[model samples]
Target chain A: MKQNSLFLDRATIVSPHVNGWDEFLASLNCQDVISFEEDWRAQLESLPMRSRRRLSPQILLAISVAEKIHETLPKETAWVFASSVGEGETLNVILDALGTPEKAIQPLRFQNSVHNAASGQWTIAAGVKCPVTSINAHNYTVGAGFLKASMQIKSENCPVGLVLYDAPLPYPLSASHKINIPLGVGFALKPEPSANTIAELKISYCKTPNPMPFASLPQIPENSYNPILAVFPLLKCLAGSPQEDIFLGLNKDYGLCIKVKQL
Target chain B: MLQHPRTNNCGITHSSIVTCLGYGRSSHLLALREGRSGLSNNHGLDLQFDCYLGKVPDVEGIGFPSRVADFDNRATRLALAALVTDGFEQAVLKIRNRWGADRCGIVLGTSTSGVEMLEKTYKAIPENGAMPEDYSTRHHDNLHAITTFLQEYLGFTGPGYTISTACSSSAKALVDACQLVESGLCDAVLTGGVDSLCMTSLYGFESLELMSKVPCRPCDASRDGLSIGEAAAFMIVERDADGYLKLSGYGESSDGTSMSTPPPDGSGASQAIKAALERANLTPNDIDYVNLHGTATIVNDSTEAKAVETAVYRSVPASSVKGAIGHTLGAAGAAEAVFCQYALEDEVIPGNTGLIDLDPALLPNVSESCRNGQLRHVISNSFGFGGSNCALVLSR
Candidate 1:
C-alpha cells in the first residue's frame, strides 16, 4: 500500500526548563537542570485558578506548544493527545479527598480525571468541533499517538494535531517511577497534502531477523537508570534534519533507531 | 476516498466470536453456556475494591523470557498468549512473508496500558526527585509496546497504533483495522485490545460507584453495577478471502456529552449501528444476533438496551456476556466479538448467564442462557468514555 501523504507543518516542545523555541532546543542536553516546580509555577500563573485546578501544568504545556505550532484554533484541526503519567497529580487529590469522607469529591478534579480531559480542554479552549482522541501507551505512548495521527490522515484524509505530554510523579506514588527531569510536552502539527506534492510521512516495523546492534552504543549495564536517553536518537532524527523520508525503527527488542533523508 | 469501496463488506458478523484459544478463560462457550463466572478476588495492595475479575488463570506458571517479563504489563501478556496460540503465529508469519512486514499493520485498542506500572512508579517516587532504575526502560510510555511485541514476535514491519478511547478502544481498533484493509493500505491487520486490573482503574470505577459488589448480572432487574475484569482479545483481520469471516460493515460516532455517562437516548449508538447496517447494504432484518455493550450499569444497560431495540430487527436475539466474564474493559469489544463468531460457527446463542429474569420494562430479547439456533449475521456494540461509540457487523 502507498504511504499516506502527510506533512509535518511544525513541531514544538515545552518543558519547565524551557518555554519558547530556543530554550526548548537547549534543554535537550542531558546536563540541563529542569525543574517541574519552576515549570508548574509559570504554567499555573498563566491560567485562572479554576482552570489551573482543572488543567495540570503538563497538559497546559502540551496545549500551549500544540496551539503554537498548529497556529490554528483547536476547532480547526482534529486533536489527539498521548500521555504516560496522565492526571497523576489530580488522581492524588482525588485519593486524598476519598481518604476523608468529610471532603466531597471535587467535581472539577473528578471531571479532569478522564484520560481525554486534556483533549476536552483543548477542544473547549480552541472551540473546534473536530474530533479529539486521547490515548495512553506506556513506553510507546508518543509513537502510538504518531501512528494514530498517521492512520487518521490516511483513513480520514484530514490534518491532525498530535500532543505528547507527561508530568513528574506526585509524592509517595513518585517513589515508584521517579524522574528528575522537568515535565515534557511535544507537539507535531501534521497536515494533509493540498496538492499532489512535497514530503510525506512513511512508517514501517519489522521483526528482528538478527541480533540487535546494542553493542554499538555504550551499554548502560543491565539495570541502569536513564531518562529519555533511549528516545534521544528519535528526537535527534526529528529535530536535527529537515528530511523527506524519516525512518524510525523501534527494534523488536524495543530499542529505537531513526534515519532521515532529504529527498 | 471518504468511504472505501469495500465498506459494504466490513462488520461484526457473528452474534458472538467465542474461541477458547488463550489462557484467561477456559471453554469460552461452556463457561457462557453454564453461566460460569471467571472473576476472582484480587488481593493486590494497589487494588482497593473487593470484587471479581476475569483474570487469565495460571499465567505465572508460563515461562516467559526475562526480556518479556521486563515488559510485564498485563496487556502484553494477554496479547502474547492469544497471538502465540490457535494458529495465530502461523497466520501472522504467513502474512508477513507474503506481504512483507511493511504491508502488514497492527491496530489495537485499550483503555489502560500498563497504568498499573505507573501506579507502582507513582507510589515509589520520593520528594527528592529520584526515579527507580528501571523507569526509563519500562515500556509504560510507549503505546507501541504491544505493536513492538507483535513486531518482534511475528516479524511484521507494518504500520502500528494503539487506540485508547475508554471501553470502546478495542472495538474501534477492529473498525480501524477493517478500514485500513479496505483502503488497500495493508493486505492484513492484527486488531485487538488488552487491559489488566490496576488500582487506578479500580478506584476510578469505585469512586463513581459503578463497581458492583456482587457478580454482575446484565439485563436483570436485581443487577446493581459492574464487575471489572481483565483480558486481551485479538483477531487476524484480513481482506475478504475464501474462508475468512467477512468483516461486512462498521460505524463509529461520538456524542461528547460526558466520559462516564452515555447519552440517555442511545442516539449516538443507534446512529453507528444503523450506519454500519447501511454500509453493509443490509436491513435490520438481516441481523441474526446483537452482542450488546451491556456493562450492567443502570444507565448504560437502559440506554444500550433501548438502542438495540430501536436500531436492530425486533426479532434478533440480544444479550450481554458481562454476566459470565465480567466487564473486560478495553478487551471487551474484541473478546465479545470473538464470542459472536463462535456463536455463528457453533450454531448456538450462548445464554445470558446470570440473568434469571429480564427487567419487565426493558426490551423483550433479553434472556438467561444460550439458545440453540442457526446463527449467521451478527452485530457487536462497544461504547466507551467520552461518548465514543462503535458497532461492527460480521457474517458467516
Candidate 2:
C-alpha cells in the first residue's frame, strides 16, 4: 500500500442496533444493556413516497446512510457503494413472479433490480453527477470497498463516499444466503487530515495463514455474519481507542491490513 | 495538490471473448469485417415477445475443470470456454508465475453473474420447502460468483471483486484494473466481464418494453430497441508491458438523472467522454474510431450521438456492434474493448451492422458498413441502466 493515509472525515452506521455513530460508540462501551430498534423506515419519510414503496430494505438502508453522510460530504465527492447481494429482496420477488404462470413483473421493480439500484437512486435523488461505482465482493465486500474508495482518494485526489450494506434474502432464499440482518455503514474518506477526521488509516495488503477475527460491538448480538459489519472492528477502533492492526481478508491468499491512529 | 494525471502504462497483453458472433478474436473480426449479424430468433426462454437474441450456442454443455466443478454454472462455463481459448489461460499462468498469485488480482464485471442458475434453482425449489440439494448461492447465484469461481479454479487470490453497473460494469472493471496497477496495488490484473442470459433480464427488459421484436438496428431511423445477448470476455493487463494494445485512459460518471434513461442533453455522457479524452491528453481529433453504445433504443441513440458530438467536437467514424453481438449488457464493455483491440491491430472500423437508414439526427457519424482504415486510438462507450456511463480509450 502507498504511504499516503486516508482520514475518515465522516462516518455513520445504520442498523437495528444504533441510531447514530455517537450512540453506537457509547453503546459499544456502555455497561448497561441497550435494546435497539429499526428506525430506517421512519427516516425514509424525507424521500418521495414512490421511492419509499419501490425500494427494497437494502436500497433504503444504503440511501439512508448516504443521506446522513451527504450532509457533511464535499460537493465533488465520488461514491463507492458495496453490497454482497444488492437488492436481493427485489430479486426474490422477481424470481417468485417469474415462477408463476402469469410471469408478470412490475416495471418499477424490474428497473430497480440492477445491482447499482442504490447508487443510481441516491445519485438521481441528490442530483450529484460525479463518478460512482457499485461493488459486489461477497464475504470481502467491506474490505474491497474500502480499498477501492481509498485508491480513488489516492489516485484521483478527491474525497470518496463509501457505503456498504447487506440485507437478508427473503424466505427460502434466506436459508441459503448467509446474511440475516439488515445493516449498512458509510464513511467519507479524504486523502489528507481534516477537521472532521476521525482517524488516520494506513492500508496495506499481505498474505497470512491466519486472518484476524472480526471485531464485534458488545451492544449488537451475533453481528459477525453480515458482510457490511466486516469493518465493525475498524469502526470500534475508530469509535473508541485505536489498538492493533485490522486485517480484512480479500481472498484466501491475500487481504488488506488497516492501521488506524485516532485523530 | 495537482490532480493526478491518468497514466497510459497498463497494456493488455492477452484477451479472449465468447460472444454470439462466435468464439475468439478471429470470429468476431470476420463478422465485423463482413458487417454480419450474429443475432438470431430467440430460443429456449419461451418468452411472449418476438425479439431476437445473441445467444452463444450450446454454452450449457461446456464443462468445467473438475477441481472446481462444484461452482459450475452457465456463466462460469462460458468464462472457462473463453479463458482456455486464444492461449489466455497460458498467458495468465505466465503472469501468475512471474508475479505471485497474491500479486495478480481479478476484477470482473457482470450484470447477471449466475442469475440463470438462480432462476433454475428458484424454479426447482421444492414447493414450500428449502432450495434444492445442490443449490450453492456462492457458486451459482451471487454477483461475485464468476470472479470467485475463476480464482478458485485458476489458483489466484489477489484483491478481487465484481463491479455491476449494468452495461458499464466490465468497462468500469477495466478502469479498476488500470487503477490497481497504477496505484502499485497489484503487478498484474485479470479484468473483464461475463453475463449469461437468464429469465430475469429477458422478462425484465420486456416489462420495460425495451425488447426489440426484430434484430436491433442501432443508429437507424427505425431503430426499435435492444436484443439481449450473453457473453464472457477476459483480459490480462500489466503496467508498462509490451503489448499491441494499451488502455490509454478511462472515465466514469453517473447521469444522476434517472435509473433507466439519460437526460436529453446527454451531459453525463459528455462528461465521461471528455474526461476520457482529457485523461489521455488527446484532442477529439486524436480518436481514430468510436465504438458507440448504440442499444437501438431511440433516446439512447440520439443522446449518445449528441454526447459524442459534444465531446469529440467533430464527426468521427463510429459504429455499434450491438447489432452484431446484441446488447451483451455487462459483458458489452469488455467485449467491445476486445473489439477495439482488434480494430487497433487490424486497422478496421467496425460497421454499425444493423443500420439501414441512418437516423438523420445522428448524421454522417454512424458508419453503415465495415471499412478498413489507419487506426491509432479508439474509444468504446458503455452506458448502462441507472445512468451509469463509462468511456474507455484504447491505443495501439
Candidate 3:
C-alpha cells in the first residue's frame, strides 16, 4: 500500500450545487442547499460549435470537469472515464426510435450510445493520443475508475486523468435504475508528489467486515444514489482534513480503503 | 506500448470461451485448426437485409444455479456457460482458497451487456414508461450486471468492475487484470468479456451502414462490412504459478480521431502495437503471429493493414478470427487471446475463414487456411468504437 500511494495533483467537480472545487468547498463549508446551475453547459459553449452540438449532457458535464483539470495536466496523461449507465438519454432516444414506424436511428446518437463516446470525444477535442478507457461497475463506477487510475499511475509511472459522470436515465428506464442527479468529477493524479499536489492517497482493497453506509456521509443534496457521488467523502477530506482513513463501499463485501494526507 | 520496463509474475492459469465456434477452448481450437467457420445466414434477429451471424447455439437453453437464477440473462447466461467450461470454475476456486475470496476480484468488459433483457422488457411495456416491478436493472440491465452476477455466483468479494469500451472492451480487461495482479491489488482477477446479441447492436450498426450483406470476408477486396456476433470469453489471470501462456505486454490508445471511423493512417493503432512490443522487450522481428481486429469493414481492414505493416513485419503471419466466428465485438480480444494461446500451445496459425479474393494492398501473408508452425510470441489487436484501440502481446 505504501508503494501504491499517488499524488492528487488537482480535482474538479460539476453538479447542480457546484461547478468547481472552490464552489464545492464553499457549499460544504456553509452547509447550505442550492439549486442546479447551468454553468457547466455554458462553459462548454466556448468550444467549437460542431463538436458541442451533438454532445450529450453526460459528455458535456464530464468534459467540463475534465477540461478544468486538463489545463494543469501533462499533455501525455491517460484518461479513465467511468459511468454507471452512460448516455442514458441518448439510449432512450434510440430505444424510442426502435419502436416507431420509421425505426430511424440517428447516426450520431447510435455512435454516442457507446460507453466510451465521452472519452473518445475528449481525445479528439484535446488532440491527445494517450491511452484511454471507459469503465462501468453499475453503482460501483467511482471505485472502479479510481482503482484503474491509481493502478495506471503505478504501472505506467505517469500522470492519469479520471472522470466519473452519470445523468438520470430517461423515464421508465429511470424508474428501474434510479440516478436522478447529473454529476461529473475529474481528478488529475500523478505517480509522484510535487508542489502542486493537493492530497496524497494510497488505495488498498480489503474484505470490509462492515462497509460504510451512505447515511453516515455529510448531507449533500442528492448524494444517496448516483455512483459519481462516491467521491464526496474523499473530496470533503481533501477540502479540509480528516484524521482517519476513509473506507468507501465498492461492493457488498469489499471496499476501497483510502488513506489521504492533506499536503 | 510505451517505454516502460517489462513486468512479469502473472500468467493465464485457465480460460473458457463460448462463441459461434462452440463452448470451451477445444471447440474453438478445433474449428481454427480445421479451417471451419461458424457463420451462417442471419436467423437470430429480424433484419431487413441479408447477412451472416456467428450465433451461439441455444444460449437460452443453459440453466443457471438457483443462487444466480434471478440474475439470468443472455449475457450472464453466456458467462455462466463459460464459467463452467475448461475447468475455469475450479481454477477460480483454487485461487480463491489460496488467496482469500476477497483477494480474488473480477474485472470484465462488454459492449452491450444484458441489454437484450431491457429491449425485450421495453417491447412488453404497458405504455406507462415504467419497468415491471420485478425487473432487476441492477442484475440484468446494467453494464456491470455481468460482473456482479459472476461475482456473486463465484463468491469473489474483491474489487469487481466492468470495462465497456465498445469493441476493445475485453482486450482492455486482460490489460487491467494483469495490472491488478502486478500492483498487488488482487492475488487473481477473473477477466474477459461477455457481449450478447441485442437489437441495439443489430440496428446500431445498420444505422452506421457498417453491416455486411454476406458473411464477412476479412481482408478481402470484396469485403463490404462487418457481421456482428455474440460471445463470452473468461480467463483467470493470476500471479506467479506455472501457466500455459504469459500476458507479456499490452498497449492501449484512443484514436481521438472519430467515433465510428478509425484514422485512415492507422497512427493510433501503430502506436499501441509499438508500445506493446517495447514493453515485451521484443522487436517487430520477434513476433511469431498477429491476431488482427479485422471487422471486415472497408476502412477498418485497410487501416489495420497499414498498422500491421508499420508496427510488425508485413511478412509475419497474421489472421483475424472474426472471419471464422464473426466479429465478437467486446469478446474479440479475449477470444483472440485464446486463439493466440492455441497458436502458442498447438503451434498453428488460424486460417482466414471467409477470406478469399484477398485485398491486393493488404498484408502478403494473410493465410487462407490453417498452417502448423512454431510460435512463441503472439499479439492480439482489438480496436473499438470511438477509435479506442488495445493490443496485447502473449508468449509461451
**DockQ: which candidate is best?**
2
lDDT tens digits by residue: candidate 2, B200-241: 999999999999999999999999999999999999889769
As for candidate 2, its clashing pairs are: none
User: Across residues A196-235, which tens digit of lDDT does each residue of candidate 3 receive?
Assistant: 9988998877555453645446566653357777677788
DockQ of candidate 1 (2 decimals): 0.18
> Which of 2 and 3 is the better model by DockQ?
2
Could you tell me which 10 consecutive residues in candidate 1 chain B have the lowest summed lDDT? B12-21
| Model 1: per-residue Cα lDDT over A45-137, one tens digit each | 333567755576555655675666566323335567777556666766764554443434555566566566666565545544444577654
Q: Candidate 3, after superposition: displacement of residue B347 in Å?
A: 0.8
Model 2 docking grade: medium
The regions of model 1 sitting more than 4 angstroms off are A7-52, A62-78, A84-115, A120-131, A136-144, A166-263, B1-26, B40-50, B73-75, B84-87, B117-131, B135-144, B179-185, B309-315
lDDT per residue (tens digit) for residues B1-396 in model 1: 123223643333112122222342337866766767666565343344567666666444555667556676656666666765555667667767877777677778776666666556645555545556567424653444665566656666665667767788788888778866765766778888877766656766776787888878888888889888777777877765656577777776665565467678887788778867876777898998899898888889889877887888555788888877778887788888888787777787867767876876566776787788897688999987666678888888
User: Which stretch of 10 consecutive residues in model 3 chain A shows the poorest summed lDDT?
Assistant: A30-39
When only chain A is evaluated, what TM-score does every model earn? 0.75, 0.90, 0.91
Q: What TM-scores do the predictions have? A: 0.76, 0.96, 0.96
Q: Scoring model 2 with DockQ, what do you get?
A: 0.70
Candidate number of the best lDDT: 2
